[model samples]
Target: MDFDQVRLHLNAYKENDQVIDAAKYLLYSFDLEHENFAGFGLRKAIPNLFLLITEGELGEPQKVMIPPNLFDFDLNLVLNVIAHEMLHVRQKSSINTVEDKNEREFQAYYEMLFHKVFPKIPNASDFHKKIFADKAFEYYRRMGENSELQQKYAAQKKEIEQLISILL
Candidate 1:
């Protein structure tokens, strides 16, 4: 579906109004499609997410889960995270291997950092860097050394760093 239809779908939830607004902004600003999404809503306990194939089938309706804590963060940060999860939702089908999973995450985080939709969010670049250095990169670092996974991880890490040097 188109952006307006997606906004209407999100508005119909009416449970997390702020979240719906953020989702709407991301959808409109990025021109992301809504046909694959079942809906968007708050989900407790689970981390912010999009329902994945592992939870069911790729053909099953998928929902984006917004962590309630997002209300405590910056609007820009919230938008970026929601955008990241939405990218996950869009790419949920491409994850068939651990390497593919890492690549998807890298892509999402990369988009989150540098999609050029909105103007730069104050400190958002720093925040994205920390997420990569502390979590995502760390996870990849722990993988078996010199293995294909580690190699792919290293390559992505270098690529992101190089891009960041040029962009930020």
Candidate 2:
């Protein structure tokens, strides 16, 4: 959906502090760096809705595509996905290996869940909480404490904490 439609829907649910906070945070974060990338924008032209991140062809423009269906999608979930992808951008800037990319994505997904998504949807089902918590714990354990991986994880944790505070 376009920004206006999204704003209208959000205004309709204005009394929902959690929803309002989540939407504001997502929009604010997107605004901070959405344009620096080579390609970035919401795409309503496809059948299967998705968020796309692509490298520009022949030095063209890199982009991020957000499908229109995202407006009807869960706000917290969509924000988490966007935050996770944004973390990927950071990871791309620092890490080169496929393994590192996967690891960072794992960490980003956890960070988004615990910090960005969970606070906005505290009443999520027990199963949902268990799944994310388990994955996060598993990722942390695999990184091993006191290692560089753990240090990066800790930094991400701090960043998540700060972002949460800002949104709250």
Best by lDDT: 1
lDDT of each: 0.54, 0.50
Q: If scored against the real structure, what TM-score would every candidate get?
A: 0.59, 0.46
Q: Write the per-residue lDDT of candidate 2 for residues 1-168, one digit (tens) a residue.
A: 254555565656444534424344455644424433443455554554445453333223334455545545555456556665554544444233224543665566565556543343322343444454455556766776677877767866555446445444
Q: Give the lowest summed-lDDT range of ten residues in model 2.
A: 117-126
Model 2, which residues run further than 4 Å from truth?
Answer: 1-25, 29-36, 42-62, 94-99, 116-168
lDDT, residue 92, candidate 2? 48
Task: Write the residue-wise lDDT of candidate 1 on 1-168 in tens digits.
Answer: 253654455455444556656555556665654455666666663445332121224545457766545444444465566666666666664443223566656666656655643333223557555564445555555555677767756766676677557655
